[model samples]
Target chain A: MTLLSALDYASVAVFALTGALVASRAQLDIVGFIFVACLTALGGGTLRDAILNRDMVFWVADPVMLAVAGSAAVTVFFSAHLLESRYRALLWLDACALAVAVPAGVGVAMGMGSAWPIVIVMGMITGCMGGLMRDVVCNEVPLVLKQGELYVTAAFAGAVAAVVAATFGLETGIALLICAAVTVTLRAGSLALGWRLPVYRARPPRNGPRN
Target chain B: MTLLSALDYASVAVFALTGALVASRAQLDIVGFIFVACLTALGGGTLRDAILNRDMVFWVADPVMLAVAGSAAVTVFFSAHLLESRYRALLWLDACALAVAVPAGVGVAMGMGSAWPIVIVMGMITGCMGGLMRDVVCNEVPLVLKQGELYVTAAFAGAVAAVVAATFGLETGIALLICAAVTVTLRAGSLALGWRLPVYRARPPRNGPRN
Candidate 1:
C-alpha cells in the first residue's frame, strides 16, 4: 500500500478505537457502539471532503475503511466487559487518534491544493471533530471548547508544520512524517505535562435580587 | 431588516425553541439547554456553509445569530415550566423552521454557484441536521434515520422546487416562498396523514440453540 494509504488506514483504526472506548464507557448497545465507531472514523474525513467539495466522501467511496471500523466496533461491542478501564485512558487514546488524524487530514487537503489556512482548519476539524461529536452524543461538553488540554492546538500546530514543509519543497513523504511526529509529540506532551489553554468565562454568575 | 435577515432570525428562534423543548424533556440543566439551543440554531447553517467551502461560516462571521440563539436559550431556561402545555405545538414549529431553513440554505448554495444536486443536499442537511444533532445529543434516535413521517425527504423536495424555480427565471423572493410552501405542506401533510418511510429492519428474529 502507498504510504498515504497506510496513514489513512492507521488514522481510521485509531479513531475507531477511541470512539469505541468512549461508547463502552457509556454502556452503549451494539448499534450505538458501531455508530460511534463509524462516526469517529469517518466524521473528520467526511467533514474535510465535504468542506473541500471533493467528488465523493472518503468512506462512501471506500467500503474497506468502513469494514475495518465495523470489525473494530464489533470486537469492542462483544469484548467491552473485558476492557473495563477508567476514562483517563480513553482520553489518552483519543489524543492518539488526534495525532493520527491531523497529519493525515492535512496531507489530504494539501494533496487537493487547498490553501494553507483552510488546510490547517480542516486538519484540526478532522482530528478533533469526531471526538467532539462523540462527547456531544454522550451528553458531555465538547473537549475542544472546554478548558482542557491543547487538543485542537496540537492539531493546528501539526497542520502548520505540514503546510510549511510542503511550501518549502519537502517531499510529501518527509512532510507527512514531520507533521505526524509534530502532532503526536505535541498531543502526547500536552497530555503528560497537563498543558491547558486559558479558560474563557462567558457568563459570570448573576446573583438575582435576593431570590 | 432585510427579508433574509428576518427569516434567519425567525428560523433561529424556532429552532432554539425546538431544542429547548428537547432539552427540557431530557431533563438537562440550564447549560445543556443553552448548548442544545445554540446547536439547533446554527448547526445546520454551519454545516451547509462548511460543506460548500464558503468563506466565513455564517455564525462565525455574524455574531448576531449567536446573540439571538443565546437569548432564546436563556429565555427558554427561565420559562421552561410555562412552556409545558406547548410541547406538541413546538413540534409543528420545528417543522416550520425546516420549511424556512431548507430554502434559505438552497438559496445560499445556489448563490455560491454550487451544482444543483449539491445545493439540494445542503438544503436537506440544513433543514434536518440540527434536529438530528439535538436528538442524538439527547440520546434519542434521530428522526431522519428512523421510520418516522417524512422529514428530510420533504426538505429535499422543497429545495428541488426552489432550484427549479430559479432555473426557470422566477424571482428569488417568489421562488423561496414557493419552496417554503412546498416544505410546510409536505411535512404537515405527513404529520397529519401518518405517512412514514419503510422501516430498515435488518432481519426477523429467529430461534437460536440454547447455549
Candidate 2:
C-alpha cells in the first residue's frame, strides 16, 4: 500500500479502538460496539469524501477498512476490562490517529487539485470528524466544540504544514511526513503537558463576545 | 423545481427553525445560530446523499437550501422568545419536516435504482438525520432514539408506503403524496394522542442479554 493509504488504515484502527472503549463504558452491546467503532474510524473520512464530492465513501468503497475496524471493536470489547486505563489509552490513540489523519485528508484534497485553504479545511475535517461523531452519537458534548480543546487546532496546524511544505516544492512523501510529525508532536504535547487553547469565557453582558 | 426538490427546501427551512430554537435556548450568538440552523436543516439530506453516493449534496450543490435555512434561522433568532412555546413549535415543525423529508429521500433513492429496503432506509435517514444532528449538537438525546419513540417508525412507514405504491404501479406524484400523507398522519397523531410503541422490557439475569 502507498504510505498515505497505510496511514489511513492505521489511523482508522486507532480510532476504532477509542470508539469501542467509549461504547463499553456506556455498557452497550456488541452491536453498539461495532457500530460506534466503525463510525469513529470512518466518519471523518466519509464526510471529507462526500464534501469533496469524491466518488465513493472511503470505508464503503473498501469493506476491508470496515472489517478492520470491526476487528478492533471486537478486540476491545473482550479485553477492555483487562486494561489498566482505557481513558488514557483512548486519549493517546486518538492523538496518534489525529496525527495521521491530517495528512491523509490533505493528501486527498491536494490530489484532487483543491486550493490550499480547502486542503487545510479538509485535513482538519478528516482528523476531527471521527471523534466528533463518536461523542455526538454517545450523547456527550462534542469535544471538538468545547472551548478549550486543542485537538482541532493541532490538526489545523498540521494541515497547514503539509500545504505550506508542498507550496515550497517539497516532495509529496516528505511533506506528508512533516504533516504527520507536526500533528503528533502537538497532540502528544497537549496530552503530556495539559496544554489547552485559551477558553472562550462568556464575559459580563456589558462586555463584547469572547474571542 | 421538481416536487422532490421543493419538498427538500420546505423541510430544510422547518428543520432550521428547530435548530435555531435550540441554539437560542443555549443562548448562542448569531454565528452559532446560523451554524446550528444550517446543520439542522441540511444534516439529513447531506447524510442521505453521502450514503447514497449521489452526485452532489442537496444543499451544497444548490445554495438555495442553505439560504432558506439561513433565513429561517434569522427569523427564529429574532422571534423565538415571542413564541408562546418554542419547544412545542420545535416538535410540531420537526414532525412536519419529517413527513416531507421521508418522501423526498425515498424518491431520490428509488430514482437511483436502489432496492426497496435501501430506499426505505434512505427515506428514514432523510427524515431523521436533521433532528438527530440537531439534538446531538444541542446535547439532547435524539427523540428518534428514545425508547419506543414513534418518530423513526413513522418515517419508515411513509417510505414503505411510497415503495409499495410504486411497486403496484402508482404514479410517482401520487406515490409520494401517499408516502407524505401516511407519515404525517402517524407523526401528527402520535403528537396529538400520545401514541407510542411498547418499550422493550429487560428480562431477568436468567436470560442472556438486556432486552
TM-score of chain A of each: 0.89, 0.93
lDDT of 2 by residue, A38-104 (tens): 9999999988898889778887788899999999999999999998997788888888889888999
The TM-score of predicted model 1 comes to 0.57
Instruction: In candidate 2, list every pair of residues with a backbone clash.
Output: none
TM-score of candidate 2 relative to the true fold: 0.62
lDDT of 1 at B182: 94
Question: Which digits, one per residue and each the tens of the lDDT, describe model 1 over residues B116-205?
Answer: 899889889889988887777666677666566779878988998988998999987778888889999888888788776776655655
Candidate 2 positional error at B198, Å: 3.9
List clashing residue pairs in candidate 1.
none
Give the least accurate 10-residue stretch of model 2 chain A, judged by summed lDDT.
A202-211
User: Backbone clashes in each candidate structure, one number apiece?
Assistant: 0, 0
Q: Each candidate's DockQ score against the native complex?
A: 0.08, 0.09
